[model samples]
Target: MHKEEIVLLHLTLFHIKRLFEQAGIANGHFKLYDSLDVQPVHIHKSKADHKKAILMLCKGITEVFKETPPDEVLRNPKMKELLEVVG
Candidate 1:
């Protein structure tokens, strides 16, 4: 994907993460992401940095889903694969 595309994806996922947090559905799953101090709006950041942030966000999102409904999370093989690859 192009840099702009990745940034857009990063923005979307960042919003999803914030929504989960606001709804009290997310725990400290985003610790790694938070520690990175790189927001999606930071276009000055390198592509690789954004990529790392994206993975951390995905990991956190998967964890949040798993925490709320373990059975449902297991049903999605791809999500599990992503969690394994990202975590």
Candidate 2:
């Protein structure tokens, strides 16, 4: 990987934040993160929302990694934790 790739990955932190929001995460308030390059992510915890949100995030990331050489979704244990928590 090159510096450009690293930069691109970091730039996509914003994209992931959007993804988190789309998955129902509030992602903290903007004003709270005014001086920071990145704000913390939050997972939506409502009874009806969490399951769907986690499923959505999982499905979306699985698709994103589909064309890659090897998928690392298996390596992300937090996803499992989220599944258990939501279930």
Candidate 3:
């Protein structure tokens, strides 16, 4: 996808993260994303950087909805590894 599209997606996810936080549903799952120090408004960032931020945000989202089924939660093994690497 184009860089602009990726940035837009990143922005949407960022807002969702904020909403989750305000609603007290957010946990510490955003640690990796916070470590990246990239925000949706940072349009100058590279496409790859935004992509990584998107992944981290998505990971955090998945984490918040703790009611997800076990099999589904275990599907993204790469995400677990990525979190470990970032941690």
Candidate 4:
């Protein structure tokens, strides 16, 4: 994807992240999906876990938003896989 496309997706992901936080999902992992365990049994989760968890969270949220209409974001199909990674 192009730089502009990435930026747009990032903006959408950020909005959904704020919404999730407001909804009471505070693990500090939503910003680092692949790094976070995203489980309640993990008592020794590290910063790396948190990072991966956030990435996964954002990727999922971005996909869901892409399928739905945009209220505060521009949904698009071309950006779904762009963010579904551990990077």
Candidate 5:
């Protein structure tokens, strides 16, 4: 991944973490493993359902951009392209 993309991903994850904390969801963690080279971003939540954890993270992401139109984020070229594959 390019430096800018990595930066954006980190920023997004940071906001997600904050949102999770605000929602009282403890131990919500995200990690990016560049070495994996596939599905590098992982969300961790102890004693939680994997699918539920992902939903919570996605909710957190939505809350983070609550003031902004979500389309604006998906419109990001790099994000758009990435989402096309992973989303």
Candidate 6:
């Protein structure tokens, strides 16, 4: 990925992480698997509450991205794709 795209991805993930934290999702975080052929991003939470945490994060994705800047998000195609997927 280009530097700009990487930056945008990180920014978006940061927003998502913050949202998860605010929502009280335990151990909420993002895992990037760029070197592998897996999904580019994965949301992870404490195994003790894995299912509930993941469901909450999935449900909150759209709201989280809605607060992010469109221009910065649109600058990276991957970010745009992710937004669409989440919504």
Best by TM-score: 1
Candidate 5 on 6-51: residue-level lDDT in tens?
4445446555454444444323233322222222133332223333
Which residue segments of model 6 deviate by more than 4 Å?
28-87
lDDT: the better of candidates 3 and 6: 3
* Per-model TM values vs. the true structure: 0.78, 0.30, 0.75, 0.37, 0.32, 0.32
Give the alpha-carbon lDDT of every model. 0.83, 0.40, 0.81, 0.47, 0.44, 0.43
Candidate 4, residues 65-85, lDDT tens digits: the string is 565545523223323332343
lDDT of 3 at 11: 95
Report the lDDT tens digits of candidate 6 across residue range 1-87.
553454445445445655445444423223322222222233332232333334444444544456544465455566555556768
- Candidate 6 versus truth, CA RMSD in Å, comes to 13.4
**Candidate 3: clashing pairs of residues:** none
Question: Can you rank all candidates by TM-score, best first?
Answer: 1, 3, 4, 6, 5, 2
* Clash count, candidate 1: 0
TM-score of 3: 0.75
lDDT-sorted candidate list, best first = 1, 3, 4, 5, 6, 2
Residue lDDT tens for model 2, 1-87: 543443444345445535434443333422222333332232222333333343444454444455332234334455445545546
User: Which of 3 and 4 is the better model by lDDT?
Assistant: 3
Q: What tens digits encode model 1's per-residue C-alpha lDDT throughout 19-80? A: 66655567799999999998989999999999999999999989887777856644556555
TM-score of 5: 0.32
Model 2, which residues run further than 4 Å from truth?
Answer: 1-45, 71-87
Model 3 stretches with alpha carbons more than 4 Å out: 67-87
Q: Which regions of candidate 1 fall more than 4 Å away from where they truly are?
A: 70-87
